[model samples]
Target: MQVELNSVWQVNGVDGLEKALYRVLQLYMKQRVVILFPLSDSKALLRPVKIDFDNFSEAIKVGNARPSRYDLPYYQLQYDDEISREHLTKRDEKYTLIVDLVSNPDFLLSFVERPRSKLVSLHAKTHNTYVQNIYRALNLYWKYAQERNALLPGYKNSGGRGKARVAGEIKRGSPIQLSSSSIEAPKGVNTSESDKELFIKAMKKFGLRGEEVKFSRVYDKMLKEYYAEELISAEAESREAKVPNYRAFIYWVKKLIPTDTLIRKQTNQGDFDRNKRGLRGAATDHTEGPGSCFELDATVLDVHIVSDFQRNHVLGRPTVYCVVDKESRMIVGLHVSLEYASWRAGRQALINSFTSKKEYCAQFDIEIEESEWPCSHIPLRLLCDRGEFICKDAENLAVPLIGHLSIAPPYRAELKGIVEHRFNILNEKLVHELPGTTKGKQYDRSVKDPRLDATFTLREITKLLIDEVLEHNSSIFQDLAKQSILLIESGLSPTPLNYWNQHVKAQRHALSKADEVHVRSRLLPTTKVTMTGKGIRLNDQMYFESDHPDFDAWKIIARNNGSWSLDALVDHDNSSLLYVRLEEEGSFIKCYLKKESANFANRHQADILFFKDWVKLEKNKAKPSAKSIERHNRKKQVIESAIEDTKLEPKVGSKSKRTKGMKARRREAILAQRLEESGAKPDQEYSSVNSEQSSQRIDDDRKKVISILKRKKVTDNET
Candidate 1:
């Protein structure tokens, strides 16, 4: 077999051989060639060798040159040179070549035998096509090795037939693939449009730094859903169908909605035509003053006062009754309570909102005392729901104090839309959004109790209320007010104090001391007490005369409920009692006692014990010790006499045997009486026994009985 050049190229013998081998390898690497060869002396010398460069074969035919019987094998000579090893060349450019021929058989037999290509011929000669092809591959590998050696720096071996072994160190270093630096993209090339957009938007909205937001695995998925699926292709002209993934679709949808949105629509009552017809901006013009548009609304708190003593002085979360200024959006007054929402709450809220001196001055920066300020320029036009709290007054008595005139949104709630709108904003922006809430105090307000995990104490709740108030009052609202006062103060603008001073003025039309006194009188305590025919008796005091106005009126004097030390009302002011008439006790006398203290003495302790236990008892059940008094009264006459005798002498210790015996007999009689009282009957003969006969049971009984009878006789005679 002979190899032919596919493409002719110019070179010397060895160089041509190397070039030819390289071409073959290039074809083999490209999977183009099936076989390769080194130039053969003649066809017979061409035999297979290993494919590696070390075993590459360059063939030479000596048809009659091997005539001697002792001639070394011709096949052995084929591998004498580096180019004769195999079918292809192997590149190991870093290594240097060194050949050692082992002429001594003894050293060759050892495990450390060195190669001496001229001496031994161990491999068998075979003409197998597969083996021959392997040889061709080895020769081709040699060509690449020689070329690599030529290009490698500091390589020394040249034009030698000796085999080369790797020398020095292979370095044991990692390949070029090992790297520490991140793969940086080219300058100005941003790969993620979606990420950049999100980062920018977030930075703008939240005032966050760009680097503060990072892209997690979730961001990738979001991008795929939003940009890949949901965003309208401006290229196409219609809204796209939603993606299957809920979170991604929701994200896109959320982005579409305005971040801060306000919606105002007419209710079932229809358009607010009255205001519409008057002026283009009549609402603003009318609400020009501080008190111009009074906004009244109820805020229900989750806090409640837990009266269940088992829980102890727990303050319940409270709901707030709020009245705000429509023009300023400032909270006018807040009445917090645990009671259900009512006109009373609203009225009280209204009162509190308008009354505070601080609220009036909040709009202005200049410090002004209450005396210096004037009444609010705006009329006290009240705005609120048409609920009972706003309408009722004859019963709660708060109606007359509310205001001169009030206007409610008649069918269309949007007429008084400011308060309602403010409530929603305030809840999300303040109350509901607050952390760490608690119970309400017994302040006679109507706040509810919050649950335990989030329940804040009354003090905590109060502080939170104040904090929210400050936030609402001083906070920069985006829509109502053009710029956020809070954010502005943080950066470009002055403090809220400065803003108020510059734009707003203090309003002074607050309640006077006299008005406060009158308001206090309305809330005075008027407890009911029974009347005697002679005078109005309170407790045991009797001083008022029948002619007094209060005597027949069944009257009471009004006083502040907080004064626990004050005595009951009486007609005779000179007689110490405030309202009692100056007269004697009439045909019948009436006594007044605390409802909790009116009970029999014998069971007093148990009654108190019952009181102590009352908090633990189930509702609507009579106490366990209710009849304890009846049980104590079942005592014998002798025991009763002994008790009276002991009381007379006041002895601390040492009683006579007769006295002890009488006491024992009394105890037995008491037990018997108790049994009867408990619905049991005794034998009749036991009751009829004489005292003398009973004395036979104990000698001391006679003496004790004699002493008792003698004392009784003397007492009877004296009477």
Candidate 2:
């Protein structure tokens, strides 16, 4: 049989096999072998001895020799390099020193050949060491496997790690010392089962609730309730109670309750689930490559920004929406506006992500190549929180634009951690350093007002953010956990832009090109507009007109019949234009604000809504005015006076008398009323001149005036 050298072999079914096993230590060239009784207590059996190889084989054949299933002795195995001498404790150092001396080949050979006691004495004399040290080393080397780790002191196993001490009458710790004779020394008490029960009761009442309570308070309550008699007696005697101390109570509490269980019991469910839960996976694990998935989230910027129209007016914090590619960690799109975190503001961010960045940056006077920020494609999936995307309006995006929409569970923000983490980066790196940042604690911010120090307008901050995003895209990311083989072979740095470009070049990206107009139309918020005779009315105030061939006919029909309503999509940022859907499957027609709604033109939907609210408020404020009350009172008086006048007038006796000479009476009454209005007498006569008589009179008057003027002109010429 082939046997490995320096390996232990067990001989089963031997004479003493039941009591102990024998190990084959070495094979000699003279057909002999050395056998060691490794587990023997007799010193003679512990020593190695040579036996006839033929006899050993016959014995093994009957006993069934096999490799040793148990671990080998210390001298047979290699030493561990990780066991450093400098880090070993004092006990371990002593063991290591003995192991080092015995590990020498000369010492091992001498140990196997000579008597152990005599060998130890010789080694001690030769090395000028203690005899007991050599003997201890010899015993330890034979007992454990010949490895450095076997020499390590068993300090970890020495102490009772988790065992609880039984309470006794006397304390099991150091005695208390007193500095003054008048003051009494504290007699510490061991925690009994009853005392532990009290501690558990106190924790359950105070510490195990959603509202957090201090351990000191809990201990105080326990002393007041459970140890009331002991406390009173101790206070009367000017001494402490002979009960378990606060430290023992805390220890028992920890021993009874686990840390995670305590946390779950002492905090609100929402807080625990959101802030204290463990993260099992990463956002990038779900993403395929760049543009495979995008995370969208909105946050109110910490710094207050001024209005774009008026620099001095602080518009408070602006809500900024960011769209980040999960795999590349690139901020693909952004939208900063005064609008709150809603669908209206969120859709703008989606639009920006679907449109080119070159044109978007040009609006802010930033010129850049398309390659610098080339993230204009729609992703395969979109992930967002439940705030904005959990609505019917968001369906427009899912049905037409992107492949799938993922709404994160409520109170779990880690699912969209990519965009959420980007918001933190923006705040910490840029926003916190701005002039009007509310980044400090409430007490720290009491010295000055951040709002008053506001310096950046919305447009200016947006431009700065655009630049920041570009810089971020180009910056090196150190925490990339995974890289593809192609990326590694290319030896490219881990930057968002580089990753994105490489993936796109390799056609590994899930990016999809979409028409900008179609994206905008689908992303805009939809509402119903009424087609009326005047124009198409929105929100019963703003009006729009369409140039489609059917628009005129629809208007005419609306005028003759009742007004009809059609589904229209409106851009909340601009109230000047709208997209009206006339048919179910047809494309949306572009509509502009009509002249009738000119007051609302070139204004935002929010501004128009605010104006309408202000008008309503003003009307409400003027409803109960003094002038209105007086006008109503005067109207009542006029009706009463007219009623009295009609009562005083004589009544007609028959219908025939009332209808007699209707036309003549009407003409007389009209002429009389005209004469009265002209301030003429009641008996004044009116004459009507014929056209022929009027012409004859005009000719006579013209001849008389011509003769007078000719005489005057002749006299002037003679003078």
The clash count for each model shown is: 77, 6
Q: 463-529 in candidate 2: lDDT tens per residue?
A: 8899999998988886552655555667888888888988999999899998876887778777888
Candidate 1 residue runs with Cα over 4 Å from true position: 1-285, 302-317, 357-379, 389-404, 410-413, 433-454, 457-460, 478-514, 519-622, 625-719
lDDT score for candidate 1 against the true structure: 0.39
Count of backbone collisions within predicted model 1:
77
lDDT of each: 0.39, 0.75
- lDDT, candidate 1, at 199: 38
**Highest TM-score among the candidates is held by which one?**
2
| Candidate 1, 72-131: lDDT as tens digits | 223223332533223223223122111121122232223112334422232112222243
